[model samples]
Target: MSDRIMLFLLGFFTLTLTILSISASEDAVKPNSNDPVSFLCHEGEFFIKTRRNHSEANRGRPGEWKTACENEVLELDCGEDKTVRIIDVEYGRSDGTTCHRYPHFFMSCSSSEAYHKVHQRCDNKERCTIVANTDEFGDPCPGIIKYLKVKHRCEPVEPDTLKQVVICENDSKTLKCPKGTYLMIAEAFYGRADKSTCPHPKIKDTNCSAKNVMDIVGAKCDQKEQCELTASNSWFRNPCKGTHKYLMVDYQCIVDDLGYAAACENGNMEIVCKNSSVINVVRAEYGRGHPFVCNNSPTPIKPKGCSSPNEIAIVYGRCQGKSRCVIPATNEVFGDPCKGTAKYLELDYFCGEIWDPEDSPGAPIIKDVTKSTVTFTSEKLNKTTSSEYKTQMKGADEKDWSDVLDGKAFDLGKELSIGGLDPNDQLDIRVVKKKEDLSSCIPFARFRTKS
Candidate 1:
């Protein structure tokens, strides 16, 4: 493609994402949000606010602003006449390619995998506040003195502001305005999913074009309980057929009652399949959701000795089999990741022969086959912080194994599991303090091959 073509594409893509920021402004902030939060500031301006320094991008009324600190709630209240739109954020700092350290840079609107909870909950509204804690956003960066740096500006309230929704390809959703209100679309994009998106769609052709049909959807589904449509040509009239396409609808709902169900669910769940051949674990919830929005729920299960930090690896290590698995919502199993904040364990897995991992000679198996298990040579913790110890997976070749690690550099504990190995293989693990250094690290690991 030529430079002009690339530039045009970039412009179009930005517009598409911009629509998402506008639509579903409230739903976008709820828990389990799939949308990225990169606040769209049409009247572009850049500003920064830190614990030490404070500034505003554009001041409606110039004055000194308040300061925010850790363990405190940061409330950005734009009284009656103004609204705020966040553009970007940087929390803590970065370590190499990852930012998992404490006081980490957790939320940002500028990243491609941008965060949206801040905007969805706060933007274009009168008031919004967020707790500066790791439990709400998880430990994006662990063991770091963290501070939130936000870039945002306030705007005058628009009489004709509309809710926004950015639906991507293969994304079929039902959008409904609050009761007694009318739904309207001010912008629309129906065409190819951008380069930042899946280019060669596995389910559709590659040569796709973008299209806009906000008016069409508004005409048919407005003022109703909900509008249900798929991202296909038949639903929105493809702008370019035979090419991968997605619909971006920017809608604003006329005021009324949006009595959204505020109830949330948080609990430990177990899945069992009978007369099944194989099973595959898709997703699991072993941690707290965003306390402000969605995760497990308002009252997440909080047991004696378990929490989010280690629940995932622990659950998968125990229940990743062909048929049945049980996970308890307790601190004993997961060792409280976030104390005082309730938690839950939810798992999404598929059970079937087709979903099983492939097996080769000396590889992990998922079915009725018996094989050797993975065991550590020593039954003690590797007490050294900087030592590369090797473990072996019996009956499974090293080539057929992958690393499943919890990112603790000097793990006070370790948890690991391997794919492609026998399901019945019993792993023998021991973590003992090293002779050189008496620090205990629990880094449990296993290797398996799927067949």
Candidate 2:
């Protein structure tokens, strides 16, 4: 071949390869073709707090600022699958225009107890509303116009995902997850948040705290199946010289498998997974072995071992291999295993997947839902991945599945529309990642249309 022709061919192949590589990388983060839903392991990390502010608009003249009569109310909704976590709250006239009046125009101050008051009412709830009135929040600036600003985030309801580990000074403890899963630290503190943690006679300095504890522990423990942590001044560099220090850690287990669900007797229970995952029932029981579970009366079912014989088979048949399943926790379903026991249903299951931690995407959390439309958002706790999402709908009672959006694939966290539905119809909806085959695990959400 001619030298010029050889050079041209080499450059052409190199350019083609580069284009292909770029396309593949783009597809990994944002899949753009019609494909079967796939399962990605999403880290169960708590989201960063989002600020929601409510203030009174400026009215009247500049110096003659007239504050609105109505009190400012702050509302937060973290959706059905998550709970509200209050991060910070400020209530007072931070700005002049906000609830500004002639007497309080120049005052710019905030309440010292605003965070405590807001956290008491809204923390760990699905939805909350707080009023910024003198009755609720003491008038910090007296005649000054005031407003309310709350910063909070939503957290998943999976209690098993979070684990707390505490070690006294000079002691060591191991942080471990189940068989295949690894650990991810959510928070850490090397000082005393309270005096009772280590509980020593000389522990009078309860205000002692150390900074960067999370970074110190994360360097030794993140993404590991088991991590040994020691609580000592050598590692944390004691924040308070004379006070006893302890190490406290809040962590999560990153895993595609391991799930738990419970339902009161006679109530319906639902189990769901991502599109690429299937339900694998590990254990199921329908009884009040524990006094706290489904206890309607002061005392019900004292027997610890009361249970139905065929719980495993029944739950497996109903929930296995399907994206979503609902079963009633009634005597009819499991046969009166123990008569008049007032039993509840408890299920333990896992999704089958050994997924890469960095590539997994957290389940979609519904942000808003209406009669004909629903909006949801998904966050990648670690690294971002591109995956096409698809939705499927089924009537709560009827069988068979119907494709939503004409089986079209969309990006993660997009607002999806549900069309051709009758009013007051109960429905179950699930979102899955687009993949080549029909197997996955996805979270399920249920809603009813307005009549």
Candidate 3:
């Protein structure tokens, strides 16, 4: 062979060998798609296991809780079909024996920020890795041994199933469910939940959040197939003054059989369901979506968008969990939203098993009353740990409830005292417990101040 031919053949053989070696190395580290360790962690499954080695990391049953000691890495896998939702986390040793290698520093200590740190890294992720150490989360106790105890669940993420959307301040967004399904809101935040959402050049505070945003948005959108929202401070009063904020809504498309009915002005609309299935009101609108519907009257419908602000609450209060409900389409029930314009009552509902009336939290009970202060207590419904209570008050003749404490939510059963009130005043007070993202308020109670 000629010298040039020999050199070319040698180079070709070396390149082929190198390519084969690289391909083999890549295949060696690729994960098995069908491996049981790659499966998801489901709801209500609690398993406490140590993370020390690869085999130990994958050893526990799929539903067990996973823990990582300091300097150790914890892996959260929700598979390809689901995402992680951190329920709670503990960054310090709650008990003396958790990571008790150092007995002297095993005193119980916990960081108040463990949940937020873990959630920021793991929530809504298909796969994530977290380091349980001071670098990840600053040492809450310098001497105490700490571990990361995380409680999480895998939520399915199918097409058009679960969604997370962020609407910037002063902007609007419409959330809609797919055909044959209704909207179920999971989480709603009117204030900033994170630093990166709704970026601003001047506003940097991300720790502020609206107290009543869940209740406000839930009353408007829950059970509806579609809803529009604007993230303006006008709607949700500024939770943090001078800081730019946004609105975030996490929702799901729930599958259910829906029924619709409409009634023109000065008419009656009766909603009825099939055998044994009660009326679960999905949505109610006391206005016109289009000018063509109920066009029998000579009066003109000025704007295409007109709706009563309290339509859903009114309809839900009257018809929720009933086998048959009869409601009138009149200004008397739902106040006239747009006066002098023709309107109609449109409702969408589902036929399903009735929701237990007792499921709702009962009315607040007056614990103590004084001239300038009134204290009250309430019981939580569904044992929801994160549920909060908002109290309101109004004069005996007043028709609206004035928000107190800037619409802030207090922990359930915590005593709240309202001060700076006139003596001998007859006031009507009410309390509402917000369960997750649902807004239905419990019944109100009446109280009188001491003279």
lDDT scores in order: 0.40, 0.57, 0.61
Better of 2 and 3 by TM-score: 3
So what's the TM-score on candidate 1? 0.30
User: For residues 168-277, what per-residue lDDT tens digits would candidate 3 score against the true structure?
Assistant: 99999999987666565556688776778778875857788886565456545655678888898877789888888999877676663545567888899988766777
Query: How many clashing pairs does model 3 include?
Result: 2
Candidate order by lDDT, decreasing, is 3, 2, 1
Number of the predicted model whose lDDT against the real structure is largest: 3
Per-prediction TM-score, please?
0.30, 0.27, 0.30
List runs of model 1 lying over 4 Å from the truth. 1-67, 94-114, 160-263, 266-307, 310-451
Tens-place lDDT digits, model 2, residues 1-451: 6866855765565466557435433322111111112222111211111111211121121221112232755667666556666665667766646544333224455654466555535545555566567555555555445777766677786866567888999999999888667666666788877877878776757777886565567646655578788998877787988788899887776653345567888899888767466665545677654443554443356553466645655775587556789999988988886675678887756664333332334444556555555555455321133335556665433334455643454454455465555444445555555562433334444455554
* Each model's backbone clash number: 58, 22, 2
lDDT of 1 by residue, 1-451 (tens): 6866855765565455446434323211111211111110101211111111112233344332333344466666555556656655544433322323322122223211112334333444444566655544444334344444455666666755645565566778887876555554444556754554545544354445443253345434443456665666765566665566666655556552211111123334556555653334433444554332222244554432222534334655665543766566666765666666665554434444322111101111222222332312222323463144333221111121112322213222343333333333223122222231212112223322212
In model 2, the number of clashes is 22
Where does model 2 exceed 4 Å of error? 1-153, 256-451
Q: Which wins on lDDT, candidate 1 or candidate 3?
A: 3
What stretches of model 3 exceed 4 Å from their correct place?
Answer: 1-160, 258-326, 329-451
